[model samples]
Structure formats: structure tokens, C-alpha cells
Target chain A: MSLPLSELPTDTVAKVVTLEVGQDYRRRMAGLGLRPGVAIRVIRRSPLKGPLQVRVGHTDIILRRSDAVRIRVEPMPQTRGVPADAAHPEVVPAP
Target chain B: MKRIALLGMPNTGKSTFFNRLTGAGARVGNWPGLTVELLSARILLAGQMVEVVDLPGIYNLHGFSEDEQVVRRFLESQPLNLLVLVLNASQLDRQLALALQARHLGVPLLLLLNMEDEAQRLGIRIDSAALERALGVPVRLLSAKYGQHYREALAAIERSLKAHPALRRADRRALEEDQHIEQALDRLVQASVHAPVQLPPTLSERIDALLLHPWLGLPFLLLILFVLFQAVYALGSPLQDGMEVLLGEFRRSVLDPALAGLPSGLRSFLAEGLYDGVGTVLTFMPVIALFFVALAIIEDSGYLARIAFLVDAIMQRLGLDGRAFVMQLMGFGCNVPAVMGTRIMRSRGLRALTMLVIPFSLCSARLQVLLFITTAVFAPTTAPLVLLTFYVLSVLLAMFTAFIWRGRYVNREPLLMELPPYRLPTLRFLLHEGWRATLQFLRGAGGYIVLGVVVVWFLTHYPFDAPPASPATLAGRLANGLAPIFSPLGLDSLLAIALLFGLVAKEVVIGALAVIYSAGPDQLPGVLAQRLDAIQAMSFLLFILIYTPCVSTIAVIRKESGDWRLTLLAVAWPLTLAWLVSFAFYQTARALGY
Candidate 1:
């Protein structure tokens, strides 16, 4: 099941489905290694609707929660041998 | 000389590599755009002179941001022999996208995996040979921070130079290029990058958990600022005082006695115009230096990026990204560097807006004048509160200016900045960076300050031998002509003249006041108290607080913005605000019979 990336709870593992934002935001996210097939782990979100910290590949990026909400993601199924927080099993349905 | 450009994403140790190769101390903050402009330095490698240009960091060549545009324009304009693609070893998966893009540009490329030491600490091991073979480029593992692997980098450059790799231009209209690059990066990383096990939360992560805590973060930021200001005052004031006394003594005992043989007019001109003017600005050197040192430490440690993250929400409301807040904070120390600091912002409009608001940040020179006035005018019990009020007013005015100017520049890119891992800044690096910044500040603004001082001196002393302190000289005549306009704001002729002289610098206001009133430095407060009542004094202080920025700041704004209209607005807006605010303040106080 897919939802807005911002809706994922902290420490949840998700695969980016597709970005629903403008072309500019999409290109920027892509430049930062966040593409449709990339696996991202929601690290933490600031309180009071602040930015969300997400790990894309080995890079951690802080994104505004609004921008994060525009990114569609599907949670990866929990599997053995994969850490609870790490986003493994990159297979997910495209948005 | 053949030109080789150092290209990388922001904060990937590209400038560090540049400094290593050229021995040129280009500013290297952990934050981006420290080297905003292209900096070229000559280095002799293998008996051949090579000009290495350190281009501003850009996320992608295709991005239309200021830095990206600058990099793209330079590549298209300049004939370059080689491009040095500097990548953060630990961040290769993401950084490789830029390298791949650059590679497609068909420039002869040497891959520099900088920060190899940090990658090792993170358990990130890259097989450089395998990567080089995979990408068909010479790759060298380098720890630029530690000055390691210089020979390897040079050898790679030499090898690439001899091979004469063909340049292939990528189609600008190819929209799917980035996706192809990303896939290529994935393949390269899977083949050559190795991390044995998933690493636990590192020290930076653990610390960010607290430092970036939503509830605690704001307080942490405030506490850091409070401590910074306290240190600047505690450590800087005594040195400032000592220098003031030293300069005074030097003038009286050495300069005055030595110049006795010269004509009195020339002697006075030298003593007042040149000596005292420059001396006034020089006395604040310790304070400015301390501020830069502290700022460098915070910037180098990577906490400044966290500060940006913390303030992003509030800054967004002002139509600026969070990084602009750091520039504003720097303004509290000095406006010139703070104005230049706006280069870090990717949006041109955001940079201009930030520059417009920075002059109201209550820089150290202005703060000194405010502190002097408050303590002298108000009773001790009320002085601190008055000073606090002025500081609060400064911030409010700055925000108001930001709000007013927000609509003028609307197109801004989203705030997507990388938060580099925190590291302890070495003392040597900190001092070197700090000293270089201090020297740059002096070089950029020093001549203007000196020129301002000389002009003020000339105006105050012309019509020679006419009772030096009398209100009949050129400065006095100018002040009298302008006094009527300021009469409603409670500024008399003497105060008006002092304010006119203060255009050179805020610190000179007190000095000018002393000279105009014929009072010694120690006697300034008594003289001020006798001349003006509480309401008038407060009005004067308010006017000084909001008035035009000093000559140096105006020059920097003009230089940075490169628009005379914006520079004029920077000056005129503040003067109008100061006059109107002071007028309303004095009238209200009088009506209340204070």
C-alpha cells in the first residue's frame, strides 16, 4: 500500500513510488538520488510540522514536510535479516 | 597556463582539495558557497604551470541556480584542459550523479574521492582501482583535510593530461539523462563500494537527535547565540579598551611630539583625519576577529547547517530559506561579511532580500555606540533594559524589512541543503580561516573606512584656524543646514554634526561627539548628559540605531548586489525609517511629559 512519504512513521522503511510534485522538485530530488525506484528510510521528523529527515542511499537529506507529503512511497514488507529501520526489499508497486 | 576546474557537490571537500593543490587559502566553510566566485591559482606540476579554477559547488550542471549557471557559463566560455571531479567518498552513491553528468560532458576527468578518512571511519571502503576501471577515469582516494595522497592526485592529473581525452557534449534537451546516470551510479556502487555491515547511529546522528530536537533546538540555538555574544563582549571589550588607550597615548606622546615641526594645519590633518579615523576602526579589530573565530568554529563543526534546519520554518515565513538566517546572525558581528555571506543562498532574489535586511542586525560597531549611549544617558538600573530594547528593536526592524521586501523577489528554489557530518575543527584550520576572513574584511572595507574618516576630518577642520570646536566650520555649516529638518527628532546642531560624521562608521559617532563638544573620552558621558534631557537622548539613540549603515557596509552592498538602485534603497530606506521612528518616539515621550 502506498501513502505520502510524510505519512510514514519515523524509522519506517519505504520505497519511493513516484513524486507528485512539479517537474522542478522532481528533478531536484532525482539529482539528490531520490528517484521512483530508490529505497528511503524515514529517519526523523521535526516537531510542530517541521522538515523530515530521510536517508536516500547513503545521503541524509532534510526536506520540508510539505515537500515530503508530495512524494508517494510504499512501505516495504518486514523481512528477516533486514534491520527494522533499514529500507531493504526494494521491490514495491509503482504509483 | 592550462586550466583545470574542481567540480563537486556542496561540502564535498572540493575547496579543501583546491587549497591543497594551489596552496591558496580560498575560504572553506562546511557550508556551501564559501568559494562563491571562481578562484584561480597557479600550481607548478611536473614542470608545467596549471591554473586550477575552483568553481562554486553545484548540484547539477543542468540546474539553473546561480552557482550552476556560473559553473555552466565558465565551462562554455573558458577552454579547459581537464576537470577534477571531487566526490565525497562516503557519499559517492549520490555524488556520482554529478560526476557522471560531468563525464558525459566529455572533458578529460580525474576523479578525486576526497574525505577518504571520514569514509573509512564510517566503514565505507571504495575500491578505487575497480571504480576507475568501471568509469574509465583515473580515480584517486584522497584525504584532503589531512593533506594525504597529493602525489597520487598529481600523477592522475599528469596521466589524464597526456592522454588528451576527447570532449563529448551531452544534449541539453535530454530529459532522461539523469535517470540513466542514476542507474549507472547504482551499478558502480554495487560493484565496487563496500560496507560490511549496517553502521549504527554515528556520533553526528546521536548528537543531531538532541541538537535538532524540535522543542530543544530553538533553545539550543538561542543559548549558543547568547554565549557567543557574551564571549564577544567579555573577551573583546578589554582588548578594545586597551587599544583605544594605546592609540591615544601614541598620538599624544609620539605622533603629536614628532609632528610638532610640521605646519599646524598639516599636523592636525594628519593627527585627526588619518590617524584617529583609522585608529577608531582598528580598535574594533579584536572584536571582529573574535566574532569571526567563533563563527568559523560553528561553521566548520557543521552545526551551522543544523541551525539552518532549525530555523527553516521561521525563515520561510520571511520569504527566505533557513540559510539566510545564518547570514543575518553573522550581521550582528559585522554587516560587510554578512552581506557577502548571502552568496550561499541559491536564489538570487533571496540573496538580495537577505542583503536588504542585514544592515539592521545591530552589528558590533553600532552596538558599541548604542551601549555607550545607553550607559551614559540612562541610569545604571535602566541601562541594560534600554540596551535590550534597542536590540529587540533591531531584530524587529530587520524582520519588518524582510517582510516588506519579500514581494520584490519571489522566485526561490526549495531549501534542499545537505547536512554534513559534524567534526571537531582543528585550531590551526580555525585560526587560518578566521585570520583570512578578517584580512578579507579589512581589504574589502578598510579603504572606505579610512576615506570616510579623512572626508569627515576635512569637513570638520576646513576654514583653518577658526576656533577648532566652534560651530562655524564646514561640518558645522552642513549640520546647521540639516538641523532644521531633524529639529522635530530632537537633534540639535552639535548632535546633527556628530551624526553626519557617523556616516563613516557608527563607532566614530562617540568620537565625533567628543571632538565637537570639546570633551575628553572620559568626559563624554557628562557632556552628553548636560547637553540633552532623557527624551532627547533616547531619540538620538533610536535615530542612531536605525540610521543608514556605515560607508563600508554601503560599499559592500553595492559591490555584492552590483545594482546602484538596490544600494540606494538600502541607504534611503533606513534613513527614512530612522527619521520617522525617532520623530514619533520623541513626540510620544514629550506628550507623556517624560
Candidate 2:
């Protein structure tokens, strides 16, 4: 099932499916290497609906949950032997 | 002169490398309508004259922030001999995409993988030669902080500048719009980078378990702030005292006697104007150095970024993000750099608003003013409480102003920041970078303070015919004219003049008081106490707390925002607010018979 990235529980691994944001934020997220189909692991979320720490590859970014709510993602099962060490995951390259 | 620019994502130690190359001699070049300036310095590299510009760090050139736009514009517009791409070697998975993009720019590229030590610690390795071949650029391992293999890096830079090879335009497209990193980035990394499978966890992760703990994070932050301030004041106060004593002794023994031969007016000008002005700047060196050095330590250790995370929620209520809070915290040491630091914000509106809010921080200069009033006006027992109250009021005022201004500058930009791994701050690095920051503070604020002191001294000492700033002089007349308006706030003519001259620097308030009273610094505080009661003292203190920010701050605001409206608002709003608040406070206190 797909859900807003912000709704994904902590420690859940997910692949971004849709980033529904304005042109400006969309470009910013992309600039930060966050785009549709990129894999992200929810590292930790700040308290009281604050920003969330998400790890992509070896880079960790602190993204505001308010902004994160606009990006939709589907959780990927941990059963596979993929996501090597998780951070710096070997997902398919961006087109 | 050969011109080169350092390009990198944030936290790559690009600035550290720049500092190593060019000690503190940077000319900050401001972009029209942008909050940030490009810092460029001229240096001699291997007997060749070169100009090096350090661009603001950006995740991607086609990014959305004003920082990104500025970089893109510079790369597109400026003539450059070489583009040196600095990367955090430990995080090359994503940083390489930036290198790939810059390669598309058709600039002769030299890739420097910084933080080589950290990469080795984490069991990540890169074959610099292989990567060099894959990208067709010279790649070198570097430890920016410790300057490991520094000579080799310099040799590489000199070689690239000399070669200035014609860039390969295989893609034939220079960072085109909507340019996505193709499989090339992965291909390069797959060829050159190796990482251990299921790597051992780092100490940073274990520490974050406690430092970033949801509930404990804030307490740890406060504890860290508490310890930091205690350490700074504990160490800085003694150094400040030593500087003050040395300057004062030289002035009495050497300067005063030397100037005693001149005519009275000229002597007084040389003595008070030059002495008080320049002396104040020199006296503050130790405090500013120790303060910034301690700050660099914490920042270098990487806790400052986590601070942004912990403080983000509180900042959101003010219509700001965590990054803005980190900049505000820096203002407590000095407002000039803090205002300059606002360039990190992505939204122009958010940056402007953050700039406005930062001047309200009780910076070290203003902290001296608060301490002065507390010691002279309040009893010793109440002094600490009074200072604490002032800090609280400063915060409340900043929050209140942001709450009001956010409506006009409301921005919904995303807050994206990198949380770098924690590492020990090297002493060698702290001294180099911290001393550089202190010199910057001096260069920015020094002349303004001297000018203020000279102006204050002239106004208070002149008419040559009058008894040193008597009611007959221009300064006396200013006090007389302003006294009528200010007396209601419980300040007399002299106090009003001191507050007026405070425009240059908050610490200048005490200097103005010393000049106007014609008493030595020691005697002036005593004279101050005899003139104002506790009630009036509180009123005057409150006024000082919120008055127009020092001239240096105002100048930076004008330069950074490039908008006269915002600059004037910075000056005018504080004046009105200070007046209303002090008036209300003074009246209420008198009514309550305090």
C-alpha cells in the first residue's frame, strides 16, 4: 500500500512513488536528490510533527514533515538481500 | 591572474580548504537582490598569481534555493580557468552526481575528495586514479582540516591551472534545464568506490541515539548551550580583563603623555577619539576570539546541525525553520556574521525575516550593555536575575517581531539540511578557522566603532569655548532637545545622548557615557548610579534592549537584503517598539510605586 511519506513509520524502507508538490518545492526536493522512484529509509522523526531524518544512500537529510506529507511512497519489504547496509542503497539509477 | 572557483555540496570542508589557501583576506562580493555574497580571495599558488572564489555550497547546480541560483548564474556568467569540485569523501554516493553535473558545464574539472580520513575510518575507499580516468579529471584524496597531502593537492591545482585543458563536451549540453543524473553517476561510483557490506555502526549513530532522543534532545541542547556559555565567559572574561588593563596602561603611560604636548582640543581628540575608539576594538579581540573559537569547536564537532533539528519546531511557530535558528544562535556571539549567515535560507522572504529577527539577539556587544546597567543600577543580588530577565525579553521581542512580520514574508519552502557525522574538532583546525572569523568580525565592526567614538567624543568635547560639552555645545543641545522626549521614559539629557550614540555599537553606549560624564570608566558607573533610581534604571535598560541595532548590523542588512525598505524597517521598527515598551513599563512601575 502507498501512503504519504510522512505517514510511514520510523525505520520503514520505502520507494518514492509520487511527489505531489508545487513546481518550486518539486525542484528543491529533486535538488536534494529526493524524487519519485528514489529509495529512502525513514531514519527518525522529530517530536510533535516536526522534521524527519531520512537516509538516502550515504546521505542523510533532515526534511520537514510538513513537506514530506506531499510525497507518496510505497514501503519495500526487508525480506530481500538488497538495500546493502541500507544507506547508499543500490537502486536503479535515475533516468 | 588565473581564476578558479570551489564548488561543492554543503559540509564538504570546502570552506576549510579555502581558509587553508587564503588566510583571512577575502573580499565579500554581494549579488544584487541576493542575501549571500561570494567570498573571493587572491593567493599565490606555486609562484602563480591566482584568484580563488568560494561559492556557496549547493546540493545541485539546478537547485531551487537562492544559493543554487547564485552558483548557476556565476557558472553561466563568470569566466573561470578551472572548477575544483570538493566532495565529502565519505558520502560520495550522491555527491558524485554533482560532479557529473559540473562536468557537463564544460569547465576544466579537478575533483578533490575531502574528508579522506573519515572515509577510511568508515571502511569506504575510492580508487582516485580509476575515478580520475572514468571522469577524465584529476581526483585527489584530501583531509581539508589537517592539511594531509596538502602539498600534493596544491601541485594538482597548479597543474590543472597550467594545463587548462579544453573541456570534453561529449554530452554537448551544459547543465541543461531538467537535467537528471543519468546512469553515468552510478556507473562511475560502481567502478571506483568500494564499501564494506553490513558495515560496523559508527560512534555518531550511538551518540545520536541520546543527543537526538525525541524528549532528551532539547534538554541536551540546553545543557550544551549552558556549558558553552559558561566556558566562554569563564575563559573570555579573564582575557577581556587582561586586554583592557594592557590598553588602559599604555594609554596612560605612553599615549596620554605623548599627546600631552598637543593643543588641548587636538590632544583630547587624539586621546579620546583615537584611544577610546581603537582601544575598544583591540580590547574586544580576546573575547571575540575565544567566543568564536569555542563556537567553531561545537560547529566543527557537528552538534550545531543537530541543534537545527531540535529547534525546528520552535522556529516553525515563528515562521522559520531550524537552519534559521542555528543562524540566530550564531548572532549571540556577534550580529554582523549572523546577518551574513542568513544566505543559507532558500526563500528570500524567509531569509529577510530571519535577518530582521537576528538583530534582536542579545549579542556579546549588547550583553556588555546589559551587564553594565545591572552592575551600576541594580543591587548585586538582583543583577543576575535582571540579566536573565533581559535575555528572556530579548527572546520574547524577537519571537513577537517574527510573529508579526511572517505574514508579509510568509514562505513555505522546504527545510532540507544534511546531518553530517560527528567528529572530533581538531585544535589546529579550530585555531585557524576561529582566528579567521575573529579577524572578519574586527574588519566589519572595527571602523564603525572608531567612527562612533570619534563622533561622540567630538560632540561631547567641543565648542572649545564651553566647559567640555556644556549645554552650550552641539552635543549638549542634542541632549537638551532629545531630553524633552526621552525624560518621560525616565532618562535625562545625558542618558539620552548616550543612547543616541549607541547606533554605532551597543558597547559604545558605555563609552558614550564615559565621554559625556567626563569621568574615567570606573567613575562613570558610580555617577550613573547616583543619577537614576532603580525604577528609572529599569526603564532606561528596557529602552537600550530594543533600540535601533548598531550601525554595523544596519549596514549588513542593507547590503544583504539590497532593499532600503527592509533596512529602514530594521531601524524604525525597533525605535518605535523600544519607545512604546519602555513608556508602558515605566508608567506601570511608577503607578505600582516600585
Best by DockQ: 2
Instruction: Give the per-residue lDDT of model 1 (tens digit) for B299-335.
Output: 7788877876788777888887666787787688778
Question: In angstroms, how far off is B180's CA in candidate 1?
Answer: 3.5
> Given candidate 1, what's the lDDT at residue B165?
38
If you assessed candidate 2 against the hidden native complex, which CAPRI class would it receive?
medium
DockQ (C-alpha based) per candidate is 0.53, 0.55
lDDT of 1 at B320: 79
Candidate 1 wrongly placed segments (more than 4 Å): A79-85, A89-95, B25-36, B162-179, B238-254, B521-523
- Write one digit per residue (lDDT tens) for candidate 2, span B214-317: 99998898888777766766777688779889888998899988887788989888887778788866766666676666667767788877887888877888
lDDT of 1 by residue, A37-80 (tens): 77777777766677778777667788898888888887777632
How high is the CA lDDT of each candidate model? 0.77, 0.79
Top of the candidates by lDDT: 2
The DockQ assigned to candidate 1 is: 0.53
